[model samples]
Target: RANRDHAAGCVTPVISQNSLISSIAQNVLSINPFQQMINEIIKQKIAPLETRMQQLEEMVQDLQERNDCLNYKTNDLAQYQRRCAFHIYGIAENKEGNKNAIIKYIGKVMGVKVEDSDIYASHRLKQNKQGDDC
Candidate 1:
């Protein structure tokens, strides 16, 4: 500290980085006004990021469920068996759509309703044709 001549006044004061860091740490530790303002801004900014992460997780789960259903559909039934003419007692090329449509028809014939063909087609009777030998 430099003393001024005559009236005994001080000269310009010097500031240090260490004192600045100490003051900031104290303010944050003590819940001062500046710390409160910073906390509010950080919370508001992070909230949207949290919401988007939740949405992305839900989308991945849905995709996984759909993939499992598709795998069951392909594995459960053969192409030829999926398309046998019940009324004619003969085999024919079946449309992927045709195989799906007959499930509803047979379900109605037996007084039942099927919602998921992937689940229904796994059954032997449903995937194959009616045979007099059996």
Candidate 2:
């Protein structure tokens, strides 16, 4: 009778341990589907934002290219304007409209022959407080 009781006691503990293991496995199985569903939901929510971010990056790149092109065009235009114009400073302001004399003076100083027709326009700038034309 004692041996029978001892065998029953051992079998009860084994059955309890198996029940605990089975319960834990069922919990893990249920949680796996729930976790998978959560992951799918997160991915769905992030997809549109990711696409919009990529589009914005492309737009910024296009704008930068356009800005660079505009800067190059501006520099070219400035150079073209400069080619047709020249500024001379430190010449005494003559009120007699001495455009020809100025041209001769410049030609003599630069060792270059300059005729009156070579200058398209000549005008004195406004004198500053120090009596210098700017």
Candidate 3:
């Protein structure tokens, strides 16, 4: 048949099943080590990077919580400071308004007999949010 085809100038394509199977097997065998090497690289380098990123995220969260606590403490300290301070309304703004004299006057009016040493500090208030001129 091959001779007849050659004599008739007809080309016959040849395909070997064994050759195709061997080529596929060789490709499959070659890919295994490369895939294993890629897996090892991910485990060695990328895995540690992922762990470090998680640790950094945890540290940032801890710092944020610490900052919130500090802010709360600062607010508490401000409130405590204001606790020692007193505000007296309806006191007009005068250039010669002495704080000590005003304290004494208030003490006498309330019959408390407050002395200069007993008082810490005093100041006239401005117009309040309710439009009360103090």
Candidate 1 wrongly placed segments (more than 4 Å): 1-31, 78-134
The TM-score that candidate 2 achieves is: 0.69
> Best candidate, lDDT-wise?
2
- Which 10 successive residues of model 2 have the least lDDT summed? 125-134
Global lDDT of model 2? 0.87
Q: All predictions: root-mean-square deviation over Cα?
A: 14.2, 5.0, 4.5
**Model 3 over residues 20-42: C-alpha lDDT tens digits?**
78899999999999999999988
How high is the lDDT of residue 112 in model 3? 84
Considering TM-score, which of the candidate structures 1 and 2 is the better prediction for this target?
A: 2
- Model 2 RMSD in Å is 5.0
What is the lDDT ranking, best to worst?
2, 3, 1
lDDT of each model, Cα atoms only?
A: 0.64, 0.87, 0.83
- Give the C-alpha lDDT of model 3: 0.83
- Tens-place lDDT per residue, model 2, 21-108, is 9999999999999999999999999999999999999999999999999999999999987796777777777677687778778888
For model 1 the local lDDT of residue 81 reads 61
True lDDT of residue 45, candidate 1: 99
lDDT of 1 by residue, 1-134 (tens): 24345224322222455678889998778887777899999999999999999999999999999999988877666654657434422334464546555666676789988566344343223234554534
TM-score of 3: 0.69
Clashes of 3: 0
Better of 2 and 3 by lDDT: 2
